[model samples]
Target: MTAPAKTYTLLDAAGRPYRSTTKGLWGGHRGSRIYGRLDCPTALLALARSTGYAHRRVFFTDEATAAAAGFRPCGACCKDRYRTWKTAQENGERWNP
Candidate 1:
């Protein structure tokens, strides 16, 4: 008999949750709506400190999905993307990615 396949819960472009065999490529905070690398230092620090960040943790299939879900890039991990997002926000323009 074959064992059941493992699955991970990830958020879609619409911020809806779904189960997939593939793991998420990016991580985010649902409350803050900020996404970044799965190995982001700031996120890891928060996780280590047990600041309830894990309770609001979310996972994304990719950056595009995260952006489409109304999430901004993390300045600590995704500096270049965060700069672009920040500039767009400051100029009252929508960020494409």
Candidate 2:
């Protein structure tokens, strides 16, 4: 018997669809890669936004690991959003995380 294809909720700069690996410690390029220059948390947030994930925590990990898990640099794709998130990280801001 064969196992089903493992799928990941990956996204691209323009908020498009693609698949990532079910494996860990991923870096540079994969076979017929789907997502383009997007990261995990950012992808998750984007997915939540478009597909209505409606979860509490967008990602439950540190920035680096979260990114390594497939999250893109929020500073890039989500610039304004990143700035806002950064501010929220500091001091007391409404809409925590």
Candidate 3:
């Protein structure tokens, strides 16, 4: 039989690596440190551009993982969470959302 497919490992909120057969639940832009759903419009548009967004694209197992990595939620797609994060930042409160 052929060799089995290699599984990918992604980081959890605590930065622990875990194996997964599928891609992570969230995608992040390394430069901006922003995370969003896999189908996020901004990501899609960026990827479609001439330069493409793949070079800066990162993956996270979950929102908590992304947050722990210092990534904020996407404003275009995650409006509510972005607002919460922004408010927390402006008020000097902890960013828990």
lDDT (Cα atoms) of all candidates against the true structure: 0.96, 0.40, 0.84
Whichever of 1 and 3 has more TM-score, that candidate is 1
User: In candidate 3, what are the lDDT values of residues 1-97, reduced to their tens digit?
Assistant: 9998778767667655678887788988878889999899988999988465787777887798799978899999999999999999999987965
**How high is each candidate's TM-score?**
0.95, 0.27, 0.83
Give the poorly placed runs of model 1, Cα more than 4 Å off. none
Residue 48 in candidate 2, Cα distance off native in Å: 28
Candidate 3 vs. true structure, TM-score = 0.83
Steric clash count of candidate 1:
0
What residue pairs are clashing in model 2?
A: 39-70, 39-71, 39-72, 40-70, 40-71, 40-72, 41-71
Cα lDDT for residue 77, candidate 1: 99
CA lDDT, candidate 2, residue 87: 77
Ranking by TM-score: 1, 3, 2
Ranked by lDDT, the better of candidates 1 and 2 is 1
- Cα-based RMSD of the predictions, in order? 1.0, 12.1, 2.4
Q: lDDT by residue for model 2 over 1-97, one digit each (tens)? A: 9998886543333334456554322221222121223354654555567544333223221234433334333454546645765676575664222
Q: Lowest lDDT 10-mer window, candidate 2?
A: 27-36
Candidates sorted by lDDT, best first: 1, 3, 2
